[model samples]
Target: MDWSKSKSIFIIVFLILDIFLYSLYLNRHTEAQKVEVLGEKTIEARLKDDNITYTTLPNIELAPYISGSVKHFTNEEMQAFNNHEVLIENETKIIVTLDQPVPITDVEDPASYVDFLQTYIIDGTSYGLWEIDKTNQSATFFQRINNRTIYYNNHGMVKVYWNANNEIYQYEQTLLLDLVEFEEKEELWSPIQVIQVLYSRGLLKPDSQITLVKLGYSTLVQFTQTQVFVPTWEIRVINSSGQQEEYFVNAVEGKVIDVQFDQSKVEEDEE
Candidate 1:
């Protein structure tokens, strides 16, 4: 073998292999750094950069010493007592009358005459019982009712009643039985709930604060709205890296709505 020729070939092969291994190491290092940065920055920060907004509603305050019962009635009975109204007799008597008969179909569940009374009659009457004058076609209370009022309208199938002591009373007459059905009302999502969602999804850091804002992005520019419906501090961020990435963050509740590459930013990076 020619020693000089063999040595030259070996040197060339070693150089090529060294270059390939170095390239692989550099790529792996870059990928690991990207993952670490992503884990640290959070989705909330990314959303803030994008200018999305979040909002929250004020809490409701309950009244003290406010209590009442519920009533239900059949359509036939309500119809029978339509012209004649029920009256409550106590220290004061209040008259309750129906311009038209209440239909059984209008009443919700837990059916009973008392349910109808609770629903239609306001509270604070001395006499608990009173009779409707069917012949007279009017409801008369023997005495004035105390701390109570009655309201009724013929437009809806069910009538709502409200009573006030310290608290305000509210009621609504059902316009159409079919249109309105009773369901358990649910409370709105709170800010804490939002945060939990984001954190659980690995979109947010538990220690980081999130700001909600309206974001508008276009081909020419991207900007955030000044007003935030939810209480939050504005945070400004710049992505110094050439790669374009997206983050998902919610204001009212910390939920990750989306995450993706920003096409415009990518184009800018290329340019």
Candidate 2:
């Protein structure tokens, strides 16, 4: 009966609905912007607020993904080693117990042990000393690719145990073979960005001291005998109570990495 009036009413109703929907969208968008801005706080400011202290961050800019298979010992290679009981596990690992424990003049110095490693380990120079656990009387060396460490990859590591006399008695070694770097290098996240990730995730506690920050590679994908590694940042922090912790961040993906190793498996392997 009143077609023109009814059409106008319908238009007004639709117009009001459109405005209401647009308002909602605008509010959500604004809120998101605010969240992002707040989240992107300056690294220094955030650290200062938490009483977390750090020295200069490393200036690593880019890195490439790398892949390699575990080194399989050949009969010739096995024979080349001297003066110890050697066990080859599936041709992928070398376990050596010294014929007589070799005394390290100064366990704290690399020079005291570097010669022993060179004389016994395959490609010993490729490994860098990672840690010396005095409580356990052990030293760990991790393999390096392109002068950067392959952080704690079982496929490429050396662990030596010392006897009560501070002499190295036995060692377990595994190496990666034919490591190939991808030609496509990716720009890595800034060190601060990675640290920020840890802070936001509550991994970095207040009143902690950031003692060390370094670039390395952690396992991104592991196969039966091979692994793919991505650039990662390993940060060491000392809490107020004097306890130390290590955390990792994926430099390429800008996310935290779980640094916990399968301790049970390691113990089982040692047995």
Clashes of each: 24, 0
Best by TM-score: 2
Taken over the whole model, the C-alpha lDDT of each candidate is 0.29, 0.76
For model 2, residues 1-271, the per-residue Cα lDDT tens digits are 2578645654554455456336545554342232223355686888898899997899989888777767778767777667678998878888988888989997878777799889778888888898988899999999998888888787789999998888999999999986878766767878887677667556788899999999988876665655677788889999999998987776765656674431101111011
Q: TM-score of each candidate?
A: 0.19, 0.78
- Name the top lDDT candidate: 2
Tens digit of per-residue lDDT, candidate 1, span 1-271: 4578646654554455456336545654343233223356564565465443334423422111111111233344445444555543331222345554344322222232344445464321221222333343322221111211111112111223322221112222222111111122212234434333433444443223343322211111111101001111112222333222244322212223332211122111011
Q: Model 2, 188: alpha-carbon shift in Å?
A: 1.1
After TM-score superposition, the amount by which residue 40's alpha carbon in candidate 1 deviates from its true location, in angstroms, is 2.3
- Give the C-alpha lDDT of model 1: 0.29
Error of 2 at 116 (Å): 1.4
Q: Which portions of model 1 miss their true places by more than 4 Å?
A: 1-38, 56-71, 75-192, 195-271
lDDT of 2: 0.76
In angstroms, how far off is 61's CA in candidate 1?
Answer: 14
